[model samples]
Target chain A: MLPSSTSDKVFRSTLFVLGGSYVLLVVLLLVADLAYSSWGQLAELLGKPEIVHAIWLTLGTCTAAAVLSMLVAVPLGFVLARYRFRLKWLVDALVEIPVVLPPLVVGLSLLILFHLPVNGVKLEDWLRSNLGWSVTYAVPAVVLAQFAVAGAFAVRTMRVTFDQIHPRAELVALTLGCSQAQAFWRVALPQAWRGMIAAFTIAWARSLGEFGPILVFAGATRMRTEVLSTTVFLELSVGNLESAVAVSLLMVAVALVVLLVLRGLGVERRA
Target chain B: MIELKNISIVSGSFALRDVSLSLQHGEYVALMGRTGQGKTTILEAIAGLRMVTSGDILMDGRNVTRLAPAERGVGYVPQDLALFPTMTVRENVGFALKVRGVAKAERDARVHDVAEWLGISRLLDRRVTMLSGGEAQRTALGRALSFKPKVLLLDEPFSALDDETRQEMHALMVSVRTHTGVTVLHVTHNRAEATALADRVIQLEAGAIQ
Candidate 1:
């Protein structure tokens, strides 16, 4: 009433509610999960061989997927950030297809992709026939699905990181007798190292959280292909809510640690 | 000698059109222009960082227009100094030699010698991010001169320094030219810098060299 229809307190309260609601919801979700699962019950669930296997498998596969994502993303990010070329807009959009696509459909696409006959041979069939390895409903499939989605996120992160850096340093390095490759390795890559770690952690966190694609592409085989996300699903499908929540909490913990490490890297603040 | 024969470069909104200039061996020349008048763009074209729409760049009568920046062996210090922030002063100074696969002992010796020459020997182990403006300028100069390149291009190297620091840098710059006898192309809009450091001054008006 003093100077406006909405009082300062009212405006401030509305703003806090709009923003804090999401924060509150997140806290409530974590709290509810923690409240539902007893420490002893979490320990008992961890004691299960299947759950233990899922834990190891989740850690291993997510790490592998994140590493794979990084390998593809770093170079992709560098090129996309540094160059101008034909169809660049199309290429940029194509890289983000998986990020926007329905995750389950991505899994389905991978499944069909393997079945596609190229040179009159299905890739999945070819692998099974020639290499004595099965990708579908297998361990490799889980990593692939995770990499497909997480790599997109990693690529985006790497691109932003590279964009934040000025190209002058690399130009100077080139003038100082460094080839393009040498400048990238010595100057550009070193400067982007913190951002690279942030990208990796983001990828790893994303890979850990990946569910739909893994379930569709890899099929939830008990000990062989069950990651923690899939483990949560398997537990919940059988009415084991406590176990599911505990595993979800475990994921939350791991993701929180990875994110904390990312914050420590301070790439975002610089950007 | 460094020669740009009617080179036209388009960089974003700035176009350096049909600008031609030459710096003879051991010549200390100042290229003066206002901001966004493509002063830095000229430095870049000579450094092989920017493409020329037409004409050619020559170093010692060798056509270097198509040559890569590394192949040209240009010593470029951008206005920002662009010192590799992640590295210590020692590493930054020795970067060219290291990339050229110079042996460890020789690289270290060269870096030490350059650092000492630039009065940065004591600062060698310190991170570049920890350096003051003048200290950073010296570090950058050390890095550029370390490889003994035939030509040195400086883009507004003193633009960020205070008057005292700028004067000191001008003195150091003259010492550098005298000691190395490298052809210098110092770009700046500051008349004082040109008067203090240059043997000849080339004016860049609009986008063309006059």
Candidate 2:
């Protein structure tokens, strides 16, 4: 029999290679399938007005949702990272619920939330009548849904980022005649640049891929609430496999670009 | 003068009970203790970084225990220096002046003067990440001094340096105290460091001063 050490090494190497190859295989297959099926229709799909509009809508809403998420996430993240308080566990769980819940459930929950009465007022109907704003089956609902889910991811990323920073830096800044706000803005915020970038990108990418919530809350109306993910779903529902495949390819491309940009930024930061 | 009157602070498993200490104005006092003996805790209490469980802190005859760290007119140099990595040495040194909305010319002049005084004028343009341990210490000192604080708190500022560098830092600290006339509370575990630098050395065991 072989030595135990040699057997252990062989076993570990085999497991590692298998695990690595499995991940590589899944990604390769996805790309290959999209490219093979959508090759002929890709040009036509790109030129279509509805497709082009959906792409722009996806980009615009994702950007808006990402920015909105960050505006809230920064303070929430800082508090969660630095402070200890009663019900902190509950707050943390609430923040992460969206991330854990199925995308369909999140979408359904948002749809249900809009219909609920708030202090004797039906929020969805009241907004529609008073502010001329409709949420259910509307464009704004797309962004709202995206924000609900993507914001959670942003908060998680930022919290980890803030936690990594040395709290002494802020204390030192405060002792240097800086108010708490000044200390946070000048020291903590600057130190958290990498985390902010990562959070924004994660949120943006998540919003870009968000489909289930948008479909239920914001109906996939062509050129209105249509995004890349919804475009694929809508096309496939109508037996338009080529169009669905093309949209899938577009999404893959966008995700690839985002990953590449994130890597590039990481490299730049290190340099 | 800086005074901690019967301060009691409890943080998780570590506690400092009735830790009272005082430093005369322009006097450099060193707090020496074993590791985890609450030397830093007392310094933090004076700097308003820690909330005291009881008692008060007075700075220049003013009860500043309830004041915010920014309002306390205290400058702190943590053990790691905690220099703003993204900022150049000039920006790091001039952070306080900038925060107070001082004019560009005045801030620049003040930053340069402190940098020159700390012998880090040549390092002004360099990013803090590029600095060596000694340079980072001086940058932290210059930043703290730029605020013209009523009291300066140094937490083992020279503990990380070599003997030669530590000696240089001790000399620098002496000159700084003489020029600025700022009351200082320095925390360290090194008896040699405390003896070399402080006007009075307070020994701490457990939590209270021995």
Candidate 3:
């Protein structure tokens, strides 16, 4: 052999190129699919009522679920971050289970358990009767399915956020005569806003990508529970590959916009 | 005056054994110890930030061991000098006054006065993140004093400052003690800080006072 150092350098360079090429290949495939199929057709399909309605419903359900998730996740994150309770790690692990669990498994599980009648009352029926909520195969069900998955994302991120904030600020506020609530609001909330916003964006994106749960629990009826991802599935099932690609392209666009906006916000906040 | 009667706080891996300390009005007592030698634990116990396992805390001779931090009237500036970095200097200074439901005009005037007294009047509009370490410490000090607390507990207020700033902070502490007549219990591992500002310096080793 040649010089050992030169061989080591060649080996590292080869590995680096291999890894980078793999990543580039995946990106190229995605671009090719979008470009060859639906990227040019988007302007024509932009006026389609069914597509428009699905987009609106997707945005609406995702927005509602994201908001509700934040409301629950923020407080839950605080409890998880600030307090040491029995089985706290178990609770944290349970929160993260959604990220690893197959979305289809989550959907099927919810359907099997909640869709069935419990003591002469179907869970969906009971919700409608008692809580005035129309559950499965409706907007509420779609949101619930999204919340179950996206809420976990918010909780995980928000928990880290709260952990990063120094409790001393809250204590200082308390010493100054602020009630604990006031301290949390005036001190902790402002400091944690960036992380909260980031968590919210991630949660919203998760809700947007939600398909299996929404499909199984909410039923992707045309123009009804048909969110963007669900629309792609429906289109694909019907051999409408162009429409499916169109919906996928739309989703990619939405995701790009969300990430860009969040990045800008993150930079602005830091400045 | 503030007093700790046999305060014993035991956090996992650290315990503050039967410790007692007192400060009369206008007196500044410095608690000097090495890091992790229970300096902070003692201050925290006095501030009600941590629960005393089997002892009592008294503020102005009132038993406040079980009272929440807000009700204790014991202003505490922790070691990190935890200022709300998102808030402006004026907002941070007025925090306690606002919490007490002081009127807007009164809170503003008090904030202005404390900001001026601490020589941070020019920094009132600056964010805590933008302030120097010395400036941030002063902002924390000003915030604590704004409440006109019955006592002040500073956990190494000048530890983060450079020599010049530390000297100025020592002067500021003296002025604060003179003006408010508030009893103070300051915890610092620095001998210089203790010797500079303390009316009495209490040394500790392990959990007990040496």
Best-matching candidate per lDDT:
1
TM-scores, in order shown?
0.92, 0.94, 0.92
**Candidate 2 residue lDDT tens string, B9-123:** 9999988899888888789888887898887888888888889999999988899999998888888999999999889999999998998889999999999889888999999
Q: What would the TM-score be for candidate 2 when compared with the true structure? A: 0.94
**What digit string (tens of lDDT, one per residue) describes model 1 on residues A1-22?**
3565558878888999999999
lDDT of each: 0.90, 0.89, 0.86
| Segments in model 1 whose C-alpha atoms lie over 4 Å from true places | A1-21, A257-271, B11-14
Question: Residue pairs in steric clash, candidate 2?
Answer: none
- Misplaced by over 4 Å in model 3 are A1-26, A38-40
lDDT for residue A250 in candidate 3, whole number 0-100 = 86
Q: What is the C-alpha RMSD of each candidate to the true structure, in Å?
A: 3.6, 3.2, 3.6
The DockQ scores of all candidates, in the order shown, are 0.79, 0.81, 0.75
Candidate 2 is graded, for docking, as high
Reproduced native contacts, each prediction:
0.93, 0.93, 0.89
lDDT of 2 by residue, A1-271 (tens): 5567978998988998999899999899787766667566888988899999998898889999999999989999999999999999999999999999999999999988888888978889999999999888878999999999999999999999999998888988988888888889999998898899899989999999898999999999997899899999999899998778778888878778877887688769767
Better of 1 and 2 by lDDT: 1
